[model samples]
Target chain A: MKRVLKLAALGACCLALCACANRPPAHALDRTCEMGGRHGATGVLEYQCVDGDGVIRERPQPIHRVISGGRNG
Target chain B: MIHRCPWPGEDPLYIAYHDTEWGVPERDSEALFAKLILDGFQAGLSWITILRKRENFLEAFDGFKPETLARYSEADIERLLGNAGIIRSRAKIEAAIGNAKAWLAMREGGQDFSDFLWDFVDGEPVQNRFASMKDVPAETQASQAMSKALKKEGFKFCGPVIVYAFMQATGMVNDHLVTCFRHDEVKALSRSS
Candidate 1:
């Protein structure tokens, strides 16, 4: 019984360590921009994410379209 | 290209944010305010902690409206202290309310924080072709200028490093990896802008 209890405790500790090891690193959450193409041209596109209630989330799904100096209509 | 969501092996909430919105540039003033407050709360805490409590932040902070949040009273602060949805740090919680008031004051002075901020990048986005994550930097001169200006304006929790993160998130700078699919896409967008 004593040996079985020790094995159980060891297993629990390993599981806890495994859980901690799987956490994401801080830098991974940093914000960034997604550029679609080249510079100084009308085709250049950029997109950022914001919460759903905000204007940044107004774009269509799958692909959020942004054209510089152009109306959304 | 593994294309794993930026915050790998985290809960689905974080994974979804990573894959969909982590680095996307945001320009709207209200959205910017929301992100700014959230990032401030994220200081010295794992992002997963912030992500877990995002809904609570939104609810407790009146959806992050500068005008609404600026009016939060001591009672509100006390209420938030006990809320499980946000980081309960007294300093950070206080900073969010203070920053909101500062933002409101900026608007009162005929300055839109969005316009003020986007102007730093010359009304356009900076496109960087980083080959890997390591190639990106945590702070830049532009961020330093922004941090300085924000501090002058009475905003808190906006240090140079955090300002750079803010800049990247709002499309003032694009740090996507050159080989990553999003890099060229954002670059193309900037040229057209």
Candidate 2:
């Protein structure tokens, strides 16, 4: 019974590590995410997470904006 | 190969950033604050690490608005540390919040952040024509002056080196190499009002 519990705990730890390795900063995963493409509608630049979990995960790139005076936030 | 400063390597994102944005003069107050905070977080880490996490920083910091960030509580700092996207340094995060408060105070003190910063360079981008990346300085007298002024204003995380990089990134000074296409292009941009 103790052996069973230890193995279960080890398995849980592995799962946690794996999830962490695959989490966020989506470019690290290098998966094919649709949102990572260029679409400069909002001032924030969004980087899409290409994980198996298809969702609205994006990294915002808010560097450029063509305001009246010049480039803006 | 197309000539560039070569510091950005061949990453598509880097190339795009170099071609489109770097060294472009920016007069926006919030944008300046965001870049300064990002540079502070870059201490002891490669800039690529920060670049990759830029989006995360923006989202977590309420787009880094001074008023919003100045109000961040301890609970917010804890939550930020747990976030997987941004650089998880407690000191850097705290410095960011502190800087935000400083920024707000400056604004309240009848200071136009844009005008105050631009005055460092006398309201014109300093045109540097270096022949190599090695020639580009890590920090200049102007950066040190800026750093001292910012520190006096009660801002945090702004040292000479970080402020120098911020200057380059914001086009307060154009550090692009003379051989690079962007050198002339970005220089021309500085003259456009």
Clashing pairs in 2: A45-A60, A45-A61, A46-A59, A47-A59
Residues B1-193 of candidate 1: C-alpha lDDT, one tens digit per residue? 5454232354777556655565566778989988887766654444555667678778887899888888989898888877766667677778889999899899999999889898888878888877765567667888889889999999898877667767766668876666656666566667445
Give candidate 1's TM-score. Answer: 0.69
For model 2, residues B9-44, the per-residue Cα lDDT tens digits are 777776777788888899999998888898787654
DockQ of each: 0.03, 0.02
**TM-score for each of the candidates:** 0.69, 0.71
Candidates' RMSD to native: 14.1, 13.8
What overall lDDT, based on C-alpha atoms, would model 2 receive against the true structure?
0.74
| lDDT of model 2 at position B99 | 92
Instruction: Report the C-alpha displacement of residue B25, candidate 2, in angstroms.
Output: 0.3
Candidate 2 CAPRI-style tier? incorrect
Model 2, B143: alpha-carbon shift in Å?
0.4
In angstroms, give how far residue B141 of model 1 lies from its true place. Answer: 0.2
Local lDDT at B144 for model 2:
92
Highest TM-score against the true fold, candidate? 2
